[model samples]
Target: MSKIDVDSVGQTREGTFKYDWKMSALYNLGIGA
Candidate 1:
C-alpha cells in the first residue's frame, strides 16, 4: 500500500499531464503540426 495523500497525487498527475501536453504541442509545431 502507498502512503501518499490524495491531493498530492492529484496535483502531481495534473502537473505532469499539463507538462506533457505542452511539450507535445511544441514538438508538433516544430514538426509542422
Candidate 2:
C-alpha cells in the first residue's frame, strides 16, 4: 500500500494545522475545557 503523508493532516484553506500552543488551547476550549 502507499504511504500517507502525516504532515498533510489537518490541512485547511486557511493554513496547515500546527501543534502549537494556540491550536492546543483552541482544542481544549473547543472540547469545553
The CA lDDT of each predicted structure is 0.65, 0.54
lDDT of 1: 0.65
Model 2 TM-score (2 dp): 0.41
Error of 1 at 32 (Å): 0.7
| Displacement of the residue 10 alpha carbon in candidate 2, Å | 17
- How far in Å is the alpha carbon of 7 misplaced in model 2? 12
Q: Check candidate 2 and list the clashing pairs.
A: none
Cα miss at 1, model 1 (Å)?
33
Q: Each candidate: RMSD to true structure?
A: 8.2, 7.5
Candidate 2 on 1-33: residue-level lDDT in tens?
012235446566344444445567888999999
